[model samples]
Target: MLKSLQNIFRIAELRQRILFTLMMLAVYRVGCHVPTPGVNGQVLASFFEGTQGTLLGMVSAFTGGALQRMTVFALGIMPYISASIILQLLTVVFEPVQRLSKEGEQGRKVITRWTRYGTVLLSVVQGAGIAVGLQSMNVAGDPVVPNQGIGFVILTVFTLTAGTAFIMWIGEQITERGIGNGISLIIFAGIIANMPSAIVNTIRLLRTGAMPPVTMIFILVLMVLVIMAIVFMERAQRRVPIHYAKRVVGMRNLGGQSSHLPLKINMSGVIPPIFASSIIMFPATVANFVHVEWVQKLAGMMTPSHWLYNVFFVAFIVFFCYFYTAVTFNPVDVAENVKNQGGYIPGVRPGKATSDYLDVVLSRLTFAGAIYVSVVCVLPTMLIGQLNVPFYFGGTSLLIVVGVGMDTASQIESHLISRSYEGFMRGASIKGRRG
Candidate 1:
């Protein structure tokens, strides 16, 4: 491992990319501490202290506590993620988006441009909502927003929108010139930034006898096991054997090759949990700003500790697992492409039969994957309820952390191999969940 770490710097390009990515991440972390104008960050933080297991707490986790601190980066990359998801969903129902999606690189550029526009629109709306929400928030008589007016709202909207736009740009730059998926890495960084504090708090609890040593050991063991399960499930794949028949070309004989199409056990990656979390949290978040009796009751039921919340979260995870997988992977298209390339699965006929077979296999895989993801995501809530620990120790955050870590390692391994150096694991190569 030490040699592999040294080997990374041996290649100049890889070294530069790693350094550049670190610099960009540093910028993001610095921005997270720069408070937004006209807000009392200390008071806001105090208010957030009581909001654990609520929607605001969830958003704060993804923002690296920026939202709690009322920092410039409070908006984070959620607006961009929401925009991308919206555009992706539109491709399934909207003909124009579908047509553009099929247009290759130029089409992707157009879609990307539109996604940026959508991100800005979402940022404006969300920032305005947050500003308005802050006006109403107070701890014992101290308002989170000192001077509340239309002017403050407008300024906040602009500041947050700009902050999100800058983050999007940084992510794009990292993707183009650095390593790994830039947006995922940004999120990984955010989720991991609070780890030290969480650890300190845990130790404090242990030292103060607030938490039993046995419970601490159990939590550590559970985390290790859960992380192992995630790594295993993410790397697991269903290989579909494809046999290419011998074919006569114009002048030379070709074809006659065998290869396997590796379909991931979890083709949707972390999208299911993310989508489910956002959908489930939306009502509670809206309720936070609205001071209605019934609305408050509804939000109360939506808390993470509620059984109904877990049920709905699991159901949504399963639904999105299939929905996103179907949208991203088409059995009919795969069959068509395979037929065109003279490839056929053994014992399966070429046309609809092949598509049906693949679909059946994919359906089973999706079911299992959904179950695995649902279990992992819901476990944290159950553990939190049982142990009364911090919400920062969540399954979704760990999943993202592990997934992003694997992806970054895979990219680094690719660079090492391309340069004739050994990878981190020597003969073993890292494979991320996405691929």
Candidate 2:
């Protein structure tokens, strides 16, 4: 591992990319500390202290606690993410978007441009709602917003919208010039930023006898096991072997080959949980501002610990697992490409037959994936609720952290391998010590 770290810095280009990504992340963290104008920071903080189990708490976690602080980046990268999800769903139903999606690189660029526009629109709307909501919120008889008015609303909207746009730009720059995915890395950084504090709180609980030392040990062990499970599942793949017929081109064989199409056990990655959580949280987030009896009742039913909430959360995760898989992977296209390349799945006919086989395999895999995702997500809520843990330690946060860390490490390994250096894992056999 130490040698691998040294090898990363040995490659100048990879070193520069890593450094650039770190710098961009630092900028994002710094922005999370710059407070939004006209808000009472203390009062807002106090208010968030009581909202730990709510949707707002999850949003705050995603933003690295920026929402609790009402920072310039309080909205974080959520608006952009939401916009991207919206566009993805639209591509399935809207003919124009579907056409644009199929147009290749140029089409993708156009869709990305539209996604940016949607991000800006969402930021403005959500920011305005937040501003208006803050005006009515009070902690210990102190208003969250000191001077609430249309002017403050406009200012809040503009500030948050600009902040999101800046974050989007930073993510894009990192993707273009740095290592790993910029957006996922940004969220990964945010969730990880709270780790020190969580550790500290756990220690405080242990010392004060608020939490049993044995319980703490158990929690730590469970966390390690969960992380292991995540790593294993994330790396698991279903390989479908393919064979290519030999082609005789003038006296030389050119086309005979064997390969396998690797389909991930969890093709959707963390999208299903993210989409499910966002959808489940929307109603409660809106209810926080509205005081209607029925709305409040509905919101209460949708709380993270509620049965209805878990059911819906699991259902949506399952739904989106299939939905996102369909959006990203097309077995028909894969089959077509393979057929064009003179390849066929072993024991399956080419074209439609191959496509049908792939779809069936994928459906089974997706169902299992959905169950895994739901268990990972819902189990944490049960633990937190039962144990009264000081911090959010699992669910979507864990998944994203593990997934991003693995992806980034894989990219770094590729760079090292391309430079002819030993990677993180040494797979080749070594000669006997005496020899």
Candidate 3:
């Protein structure tokens, strides 16, 4: 492991890329501390203290506690993420987008441009809403925004929208010139940045006898088990064997080879949980700010600890697991590609039959993956409701952290192997998401 760390810096390009990524992430974290103009940070923090199970808390987590601070980056990268998800959905339903998606690099650039546009638009709306919401919010008799007016609203809208756009640009730069998927890394960085504070709080509770030692032991054990499960599931794959037909080209025999298509159990990766959480939290988020009787009641029932919320959360996870898998991986295309290359699944016909076989295999894998993700994610809420475990130790956060770590390590290993250096895992390699 130490040698691998040394080898990373031995390659100048890889070292530079990593350093650059770190520098960009640091810049983002710095922005998270720079508060918006008018809001009282302490009061905002106090308000968030009581919002632990609400949408505000979830948003704050994703933003590295920026929302609680009312920082410039309070909106975070969520608007951009939401826009990207919207665009992905559009690719399936909109014919023009479908055509554009098939056009390769140029098409993707177009889609990305549109996604950015949508991000800016969303940031503006969300920022304005937040500004107005702040005006209405108070800790006791003290307003969150003491000097509230139209001026504050416009300024906040501009500040937050610009912050999100800047974050979007940073992610793109990191992806183009640094390592890993930059957006994932940004979220990973945000979640990780909060770990120290959570640890400190946990220790405070332990020292004050608010949390029993046995409870702490159980939390540690559960975390370890959950992490191990996630690692195993993320690495699991169902490899379908394929054989290339023997063919003669001139005087030489060619094209007699065997390979297996690696179909991952969680082909959808961490997307289902993210989408499910966002959708489930939307109404609750609105209810948190708006105090209508029905809205308040609805939010109460959909709290993270509520049975109704868990039921809906699990259902959404299962639904999105299948939906996202279908969107991203088309069995028909894979079968066609295989057939064009003179390859066939051992027990299946080339074309449609092979497609059907792959589809069946994928459906089963997706179902299992969905169940695994739902169980992991829902477990935290069960603990929270029954045992009062902190939300900081959520399964979704761990999933993203572990998944992103694996992906980054996989990319790093590829670079190492390409340069004839040993990877972190001796005599082995981590399979990337594509595999």
Candidate 1 residue pairs that clash: none
- Model 2 over residues 79-167: C-alpha lDDT tens digits? 88888889999999999999999999999999999999999998898888888888989987899988989999999999999999999
For 153-216, candidate 1 gives per-residue lDDT tens digits of 9999999999999999999999999998888888888889988998998899889998999988
How well does candidate 2 score on lDDT at residue 396?
77
Question: Sorted by TM-score, highest first, which candidate order results?
Answer: 3, 2, 1
* Candidate 3 lDDT, 272-353, residue by residue in tens: 8887877776557656777688888888888777789889999999998998999889999999999998999998999999
**At residue 40, what lDDT does model 1 achieve?**
88
> CA lDDT of each candidate?
0.88, 0.87, 0.87
Candidates sorted on lDDT, descending: 1, 3, 2
State the displacement of the C-alpha of residue 251, model 2, in Å, after optimal TM-score superposition. Answer: 1.3
Candidate 1 regions off by >4 Å? 250-252, 421-435
TM-score of each: 0.93, 0.94, 0.94
Number of clashing pairs, model 1?
0
Model 2, TM vs. native: 0.94
lDDT of candidate 2 at residue 90, scale 0 to 100: 91
